[model samples]
Target chain A: MTTAKRDTYTPETLLTVAVQVFIERGYDGTSMEHLSKAAGISKSSIYHHVTGKEELLRRAVSRALDELFGILDEEHARVGSAAERLEYVVRRMVEVLMAELPYVTLLLRVRGNTGTERWALERRREFDHRVADLLRAAAAEGDVRSDVEVRLATRLVFGMINSIVEWYRPDGLDGRGGSGGAGEREVVDAVARLVFGGLRKAS
Target chain B: MTTAKRDTYTPETLLTVAVQVFIERGYDGTSMEHLSKAAGISKSSIYHHVTGKEELLRRAVSRALDELFGILDEEHARVGSAAERLEYVVRRMVEVLMAELPYVTLLLRVRGNTGTERWALERRREFDHRVADLLRAAAAEGDVRSDVEVRLATRLVFGMINSIVEWYRPDGLDGRGGSGGAGEREVVDAVARLVFGGLRKAS
Candidate 1:
């Protein structure tokens, strides 16, 4: 969370290295030895900064969860009509997913293999519930399509949003990679357009 | 591929067990010993059916890839307007993904850690490029919204499709799990609805 110099390798700096290793090797496959090798530090030094690999996963996932959970509390998400609020949440979620790409990538791949993973899954369900409510309200107001079930629509939208982590590369090498400062901006717009094509294009 | 009994443990039957363990423990985390135990057979028995863990992975991903590639050769995907062909591929893809859930699940999780995984990744990209052409043709024909970039739209659509592997458990124990006999049917419709809302719902 600190904006320390790039030279310093604090718990936060070490986390960037740890997360990359976790993503490269499956979380279960990754070890303190792997982290130490990737971080250019010793096993004892990694232990010095954090309890262990699980702790690193905990910290890394917490950062992603915090950023995601923060969106629900935003005034736009809280204040608008159900349909409007849904769009706001959808667009912001896209932006947040990109801004915190690596953390979010790790979050999406959690398979409930550990206590930290289980907890992350539970928290994610909580976030889904919050978004689902906005969508349900939108349906009730007839601002959203009624032909599709709200829960089904919500999961599909989440599917679309979460898919970003699977293929989106920051440097744009994948051809579809989110590159440049406008990359996230373009993603946000496209998601908003797809989710609410009727409402978005109408306006 | 055979409709044998649930009691007998053939190579195909044993594959189901291996795929589940791979999904639960992850491909890297799973071992031949783990597969033998989970399948209720000895490691030697597993070897008799197949070579080892990597072979199981190769088999599982091959099943997924073959089903997906088969879609393009179908009449619907081959002889239609670009938009229609794209729709056919998308709907059939959802069906294929649901039908081959376990196998596709393993395929999607392949991270190129082994030769099998790298092969799966390459095959998947080939499929993506094929779909990309359909989208591109549709865009040229002005069927889909050309306002969005084809490459970006293709990735998002694939993202949405690939996500079915994540939360779609047919039996529904996970409260958020996709269930009901109509689950795949609904998913097919929902994805179609989301992607080409204008082209699809209008009809």
Candidate 2:
């Protein structure tokens, strides 16, 4: 049986601790003891906060998935010309990734080791598909370059954007700056300009 | 006691198996039994091939490192205008990445869990720094855009190129007709052209 206390824990707070542990020890290597230590709460206290380890993983991935899928529902993403919408989604992706760095980082690294991880992988694929559609639409409109296949372009764009988790340091001192007037927005802007405008000099 | 045999397994063959397992189970989760089973050889037989798992990892990463560092020593990468040399390096990078997809993929996925992985990570950073110097030189020459920081441009370019491994399936079923044409080269060429040139159409 699980013990419950009113003032102790919320799912969100527990998830914060869990995501950090998951990133540090890796999802596969992390166990309940590690979680208890990281959370500063007893193992049973963690159970009180969430169902089990997998539940915490599910909740964290779900939060990231929800945020990413939410981008598609926005008016700018939903109703604009494909090129405009693609640009908007790209910017929003960079913002979302930065805002939810740790969670999304976990989501990106899931290797389908558990039921929860498999679910995260599926949701991630669904999100990629939705974004790929936008790229396809843009290609059809000829607003973006059609020289590259829509699938390849989508993956490459994602690669450029998603690689942020590999080196992006929110605190700015991990050797990649965040305070040089080049915060998340600047990154989003640079990605958008480069992807859409290409890198050539304007005549 | 580990057995020594007169007839030996080569490091290259051992590296091939190690890289595959590393990709499947990830670097941290795999063990010697897993490798032995995959190799269809005895545990001692594996020792005949290499020193241990770390040696296998070191050898694999070294192959990737050699290929990448070799690019810098090439004539095209050494002498011409910075912009031209940068272009040659970029194009050659795509070609080399395709040619050495597996080794580079493993090198990129390492998380610095062990001494070999840490060394690989350091080497990767050194390679990135070397490429960044080329981009910096190009910017200094006024050949590339000065609006974006040299570090940022270097990362974005690396992001685009490194992304190829995620989607590329050297032996995937669709290989017969998919992206196997001039279409792939065109995309690489376009990426180079765009990086050197901005997206704006000239008057």
Candidate 3:
């Protein structure tokens, strides 16, 4: 892979490369020097592409946050029954996560140590609140169980879904029998089944 | 906090210090110098207490693993109806996670970047597999729903339980009408409801 030749780099391309390094070495562990080495450019040249490491982090997280927030604005996600809307959001979340794997991975791993990280976290909380509202609506409609608090259920469901970044390797899934979106579809389907039908044998 | 000052540090003391730094800066981002400064000891003095950073990591993860594995071996977890045993393990896992919060947090965050990390990851996986087996047994007994894969259910449930570490603040819980462990109990209760009855309204 290292033997592959490289052409001129754009900010978009550099962002991708920098995000990979940030995820691997961690944001704090990485420096301009490391970014330069990874990008195959001088530190000064790298600086010309982006202001600094934090800027790269901000861009990466913003990309993820935008995609996530975009799900809520979709017509299917907005106009359906609460449960259906919830399912659409879940499926879209998985697709967005996979489509922007590296950026989303970086977004999930932020520790809130920097201003950019705090912003990312706050926006993430907003996304969760939006979903929680949908869950609450579903519960209110008597479509889903109301035994659990809306906030609590939302967090658990979000946890189940968001934990995908920890282990969902895109490379591993490509070799399997499904389409590009199959893994996301599987998770969305499984989550819906587990949420609605549960794990108990049918009576 | 630093101004309180201590002259001597034991393994327990050093671990408390190390865990704080690990949580703040992340395991891979933290170095011996960082540990030494945080612990208010020289780098060489840190070596005297623990062989190295990885030993500290190993000791930390080991303590967490012991607590988790102990939950599965407990009487409640071992001798009960499948559902009962499952609930017992779930509740106890939450309690263990809370009691061993910092240590378990460290263990969960390990990325398998080093030998110590790989060992922690492997043992943690073993613990997960052990729980998955119990979940499988419960499903085989016609307890859990058979529609979803046991492995996927196990991961999602574990994800729900482990995510408590991310947002749970003991102080915040205490400020509520509850004391310590209240948060964990709530999570356990929430998870049990979700896993057993699910989100669907009963017919």
Candidate 4:
């Protein structure tokens, strides 16, 4: 690589390349050699930006975790009826996930193999519990269904929301070949509808 | 280790061990050495059961795909109204997923890096399309909400169902300290209720 190109490679840019490699190759399967090759820089150049691959992994997941935890502290999430707050958080989760697709995708795929991964998993459980508590409150106020257990309901709802990373491609056109706007709004609405109202048309 | 234990290893038994390792270490990360170590058999004995790691992957995914495809042929999935059939298939999917949790978990995580992985992915998409067609049919019959696009709705619902593999532990107790029977039934019922009626209590 040229000196100018090497000089231009910042930690943020290196992290972008590393996250792609980590996602494509499982994090455990990825190596410093792979990141250096993908970045078109020498291994030393990579080391200069971050300590190692674990540092990159840490930065990437921390970014995702920060965005997710940020949702819980928002005013809507704090002040509304439990059900309404849950809805706002759900919609924002979709938006945040789409906005930070690659980072959140990496976060969702971690399997707790390393220290960073275990920390990410614990934070994820904490996030899920916060959302579950909202659902529990909603159930108590008779806003959501009492028929299902709150924790079970929370998991299923989250399962619906988090599963978006599996298929959503922001750059791609919608199913009908429309632009991203309609497709994106439809996802948020569909999730809210399906989560609260369900697939069956109301009687 | 022992001749008696070595003699007892059948292809089915070997596969059971292989799938567990594949889930823990990931298919790409695992090797024949990992498999032999986990199975307590020699590497040659593993090769005796299957040609190589790829064969184990192919066999493991094939079993999962076969079970999922089998759901489409069952009477309830075939003979009901579009909405009813979709509901039946959804319920059956949760049951099949929980029943064959480990195999299907491995199946859901495939990233299409290998030929076998790509084949598994293709089969998965095919199965998804088959179910998507059911959702489309339900929408056409005016049995489901018409506002959300059919294909989009299908993806979101599939996302919910598939995400179960991430968290549901069959041997684990329920939130309220209940046993697996009630917990298991609750999952199926919760999914069906959430998928159809959603979380909102009816007015």
DockQ of candidates 1 onward, in order? 0.34, 0.42, 0.49, 0.66
lDDT of each: 0.81, 0.78, 0.80, 0.86
Which scores higher on TM-score, 3 or 4? 4
lDDT string for model 4 (A1-203, tens) is 35524546888988899999999987988999999888988889888899999999999999999999999999999998999999999999998988898999999889778999999988988998899999889889989899988777877788888888767878656463422334577788888888889999887
How many angstroms is residue A137 displaced in model 1 relative to the true structure, after the best TM-score fit? Answer: 1.5
Q: lDDT tens digits, residues A1-203, model 1?
A: 53323335799999999999998887988988888778776788778888999999999999999999999899998897887888888898998898899999999888788999999999988998899888888878777776777677777789889988776666656653344223767878877877777211231
Q: List the residue pairs that clash in candidate 3.
A: A145-B199, A199-B144, A199-B145, A200-B144, A200-B145
Model 2 per-residue lDDT at B146:
68
Measured against the true chain A, the candidates' chain A TM-scores are 0.89, 0.91, 0.88, 0.92
Residue runs of model 2 more than 4 Å from their true location after superposition: A1-7, A175-181, B1-8, B174-203
Error of 4 at B176 (Å): 15
lDDT of 4 by residue, B6-78 (tens): 5468888788888899998888789898988788778887777789998988888899999999999999999
Q: For residues B80-159, could you state the per-residue lDDT of candidate 3 as single tens digits?
A: 77877987898788778878989989999887789989888889888988888988888878777777777777777787
User: True interface contacts reproduced by each model, as a fraction?
Assistant: 0.33, 0.36, 0.67, 0.88
Better of 1 and 2 by DockQ: 2
Off by over 4 Å in 4: A1-4, A173-182, B1-5, B173-182
lDDT of 2 by residue, B72-176 (tens): 999999989887888889888887887888899999998877888888988988888888888788778877666666677678878888987876665543433
Score candidate 4 by TM-score against the native.
0.91
